[model samples]
Target: MAAACGLTAAATMLPLVLGGGSGDGARPGGRPLAQAPPAKAPGAVPAKAETCTDPEASLQPSSADGPTIDRIKKAGHLVVGVDQNSFRWGYRDPATGRLDGFDIALVRAIAKNILGSESKVTYRAIPTNQRIEALQEGKVDIVVRTMTVNCERIKQAAFSTAYFQAGQQVLAPKGSPITGYNDTLKGRKVCTATGSTAYDALKAKSYGAVFADTATAQRTVPNQLDCLVKLQLGLVDAVVTDNALAAGQAAQDPAVDLKGDPFTTEYYGVATKLGNDDLVRRINQVLVDYRKGGNESPWMKAYRRWLAADLKGITGPPAPKYR
Candidate 1:
């Protein structure tokens, strides 16, 4: 995903420290934090009438149902998992020390509809690999970490409708002769994140591009300023990564440029724990509303504000399949 709004770890850490308690505040030592008092057996009637009101009263219309929504209502807040390192999609604001990005806008919209306040959102910065695991373990209520929804991931978690469309692109020095996927990569070394789909796709194509398993393709460069630094320094020939990320790298350094068209398409989705239909439905409803009336909602406004400026010729939300 492109780094439009900047969701950085240092930005998210401020909220974590202010909120207090260990991450998630779940029970320690492999036990529930506080077990509920023994309750009457199933089919038994309650002794007193329940006083809590339906929190969904304020939510927009939706047919989907699940426990994720209920949990957020009960807790009076929404916990969203996101990536801090990716520049446009998510990153930290050095000035405010808070997490904000295109995905963060969606999280705020959902929080406003559910909690009636945007401040109800609790941002959790997670590594790319931990996005699904965090949701599965109940460490977060939702994962907005630019996750791609595929059949395999579906088995582990439910997904909201697609919100972004992306594809793989190669990053190389500005004046390199390599221009497209068909170019000879036999002797060129490519840097990509370990276990990333980009690696698999490149390998499947038998491109003969050497692979460097780094934590983030952006960091594989010798310095933070230029992804082409390695190539300039003769450390590597090119960097293979997503087009959006490649755009970020090019924007950061004039010496680098994206080569050719994207190699593969990737759809971005919000991830929830497996079987958490309620939360997923609620989020889907928000997306539906945002895309309604042929109007750009606040979420899209934020997205455009941060993303459009950097990705020239790219504007508005992704297509229906991606939205």
Candidate 2:
């Protein structure tokens, strides 16, 4: 299959960072940190469990400006939290040193709608575990990373309507005995990004895999790319992550490929600090226009340019659901 997510020629040839170098997400010979506290920040009211039946249903789209939008406009730029290590989703181009990918394209679209210039935006690299913290701490105005929309997450953050549909899947070497997400992985070393849904899924049912973070072996990493590194170096037998992201990893290495069908249904969305309904609603509006024009829509165009080859058979973006 053709490379998915527009993996740059340079990205496919990236040298392996063997020593757990900076920004590589490797933590060789290090122990996983203590469990993080709850997703809600101190003094923040948690969302009632009953209110989150449909996490993907968001406020109706509105172009009217609010305090959040006014502040970003006044500052003349939008601040976006993104991932720079995910090959085809939000990675920085090694050749140009500029962020490019499906997520980055959406960030630029939001900036253009808010500030009249896509370049008038600052990108901050947010780790998978810190996406909520960054938003609650006001470190970033919005997070366009491939964040999943879930009831627990909606309790801590506001999400726009679902932008993309993805699911948990396994990625392993070309000829590994590890079948899909089933018993083939029993007793094997499987890697996943810390605080990711994949980690949660594994915790619920791992088929006897040794995936927990330990003092001797750090199975969890700061970013998903680190899992790929571990797989390449024989440290981990398999990697479990969003298939959307796993597709990019497979593009980077011909030896590895997605092993099975996605095991769970999930939706990707734009996230803001809890109660940032204005920003959330505004983002919904941007997405409304982004998903227009059928196959010619910006959402479809992005898929064709960045994700179609590997994540095939998608006709269009997910329809928006309003609360």
Candidate 3:
């Protein structure tokens, strides 16, 4: 029965990526790459919040019991939504027919801690835009995508304390003239996932960059090697994605490199439906316990296994708080 379930899940994923489902929103055809306008440095003060209420403070976890933990316990499984396309964060191995990455490892650890077995996890591969919505609709219990825990996201879902710190960065082919975010690539096309924070940040910087939907961006030349393959083929001058993702790309292909230091550091956190305090608290406890023990925790071991190359020589304390 378990084998059948896994096969069904895998079948569901294949069409989604092969452009056969409603999920494939846009096709990948575009004009030749144009140079993007020079972008200003990223440290400009953010515009004042028009809405006075703090999103984070408003969504604070309560001590009251919530449905998420109860649902997991009753089902005897942990349903985690994650990005299956990201290399270091989450992706499937064709040879092993298994999904693995830093985020997957962490989710497995959470399942083991909560259900006493790692096998109790049911992985749901989710698109970037659907992560929070999936959680809110009860389609998944938790979202462990490389999702940023921002004030805006907190408005919709509760977030675990940060598990990884990342920032916005640019990926360019080797020897590209673009040195950093501030470099002028004016009139040059830059590719970024549609509806992503990287796009938002680049827009905010007034880079006048072009945008491509994520699916389209992934299909262009060299096939899923990295987000910046378009740049390597000169389809676009640059690609903007998370710094961690950029790092992984650089590690894999010496021909591609991350340009400039990352601007605007943000924390990656697990996301759950709004008002699920009991589950949030339980997860928080597990996170706190993991931190106290350093990299000895199961989560850390998993991190090392899947992300050792990206996280090489890096050591740090665990996150300060959970949900």
Question: What are the clash counts of all predictions, listed in order?
Answer: 17, 1, 12
Candidate 2 has its poorest 10 consecutive residues by lDDT at 30-39
Give the number of the best model, judged by TM-score. 2
lDDT of 2: 0.79
- Index of the highest-lDDT prediction: 2
**How much lDDT does each candidate structure score?**
0.59, 0.79, 0.61
lDDT-better candidate, 1 vs 3: 3
- Estimate candidate 1's alpha-carbon lDDT, on a 0 to 1 scale: 0.59
Query: What are the runs in model 1 whose C-alpha is more than 4 Å off?
Result: 1-66, 212-235, 293-295, 319-323
Residue 114 in model 2: lDDT:
83
**Cα lDDT of model 1 by residue, 2-95, tens digit:** 2311322233343321123356535222110011122232232221111122111122336454565666767777777876556566767676
- Which parts of model 2 have CA positions greater than 4 angstroms off? 1-52
Q: Which stretches of candidate 3 lie over 4 Å from their true place?
A: 1-66, 212-226, 321-323
Ranking by lDDT: 2, 3, 1
Tell me the tens digit of each residue's lDDT in model 2 across 16-97.
Answer: 3222223322122321001112122222222222245777899999999998898877777777788888877998787787
Candidate 1, residue 204: Cα displacement in angstroms equals 1.7
